[model samples]
Target: MTPDLADGGAASAAPSPAAAERAARAPLMSVRNVTKVFGRDVVALRGMSLDVRQGDFISLLGPSGCGKSTALRLIAGLSNPTSGRIEWAGGGRTDADLGVVFQEPTLMPWATVAKNVWLPMRLRGKSFASCRADIEDALETVGLKGFEGAYPRELSGGMKMRVSIARAMVTRPKMILMDEPFAALDEITRFKLNNDLLAMRAKLNCTVIFVTHSVFESVFLSDRIVVMAARPGRVIHELNVDEPYPRAEIFRTSAEYAAQCRAASEALNEAMGGAGAGHE
Candidate 1:
């Protein structure tokens, strides 16, 4: 069973000892020296490589125009890398085992939240009645239990994003790929969703590969932050966040967090050009 965090901020559930023991078993998904090039000279990715261990919360972070989204698309099989290969743990190329959330909600306007969340299963040929319990559970997980019957137009921006998350979770995917899933939300809503996402990750035990530009969000949510450089995106730095799960707001205010964020900011600055190029 997953350990639930206590109200006083104690980590009730550290990662399972068995999970720790199997840490090096093999990555659930592996991106091996992947590269993506557009016609003739435009390169999106350049020999990028990373390993996503089972149940890891990995984030791909970089400035605008960096290939963060392209990397995620390559993993999702939505776009093929021009060079290099992405292999699943035991060696496979299909994305049937993954779920993907785009930057936008992309929900069906006519479908109820429940129906929209049920789309993945339905596409897989699963019947609605057969997956009713799973749909309800997913909705509840995203804090949208009572709004399952509501349409997309009736929901607020945050609620719509929750619906998008619920849809991704309903499939019981082995891995989830998120491309700045919360970038469009307001600060308050984004923070709330960030906390909710951490809680959900602890409970679900699924691997996540998220793409974002926010250093603070990357530090708070990732087990490992992969910082990429622009123009033919390549890895410039990889930083491991050693903090425990269910991270608290206090950690956000601590010196350690600031230091790491500063390090990331520096790397990102250098990647963009130099220290004085952009506003940190």
Candidate 2:
């Protein structure tokens, strides 16, 4: 359940020292001048750059051809950038350090939910029996406690997506990349998942880079929204929601949310017009 925030922010008068310290620290990851070009004439992304700090919920909000997924794939190391680089504050990246959830649930049809969630660990030579407790805990966290033995076909679209999220989170990576994980669900389900996702992030303190086509979803879920342009896709503007997390339905209906939506909408319009890509 979402906790009621009295003022919609500031559970207390003064910010905690931990909060201040987190704010002061450097970004956890930096994408510097990254551009992705597919064969001869296709350019999926160009000169894209952004910083991802720990505990951030950033949404890459853009249109059809804006390369949002391409950016995510690049960050996940599924594809290499044509130019520029992605740098981690600590060191180089390894498969174990990142988690990725695509728009599709992408669970194995023949496998049980627990088996699917255990795949990552199993790939690292950990036996399914050995990871049973971790798998059950992840399923419980995602509200799928007793459905472990169920298969994907037995679950609803939303439930399947929850299983997908559980699989991504079971490893407890420092960062998670979601490429429209909730886009296929119905509005009611999406809203429910949105709330659950924030709650999960709060519990895990994981950095999230989300890609979304909906301005409302972006504004509702993100601490920062990066608006992108097409025609060799790139970022044109970035807007900070600057709102506190664990935000409830009340925040969705608040005047502040409305204003933020308007700003994001306007930015989207400009991006579609091919506004010059902006810089930090």
What tens-digit string does per-residue lDDT give for candidate 1 at 1-280?
A: 1111111012113464433543654578778889999899989889998888887888888988789988998888888989898888776744357887878898999999999998999998999999999999999999999997899999999999989988888887888889999999999999999999888877887889999999999988886778888876888777666576779778889876877677667666767767666534
**Which regions of candidate 2 deviate over 4 angstroms?**
1-22, 274-280
Deviation of model 2 at 261, angstroms: 0.4
Task: List clashing residue pairs in candidate 2.
Answer: none
* TM, every model: 0.89, 0.89
lDDT values of the candidates? 0.81, 0.86
Clashing residue pairs in candidate 1 are none
- Name the Cα RMSD for model 1: 7.0
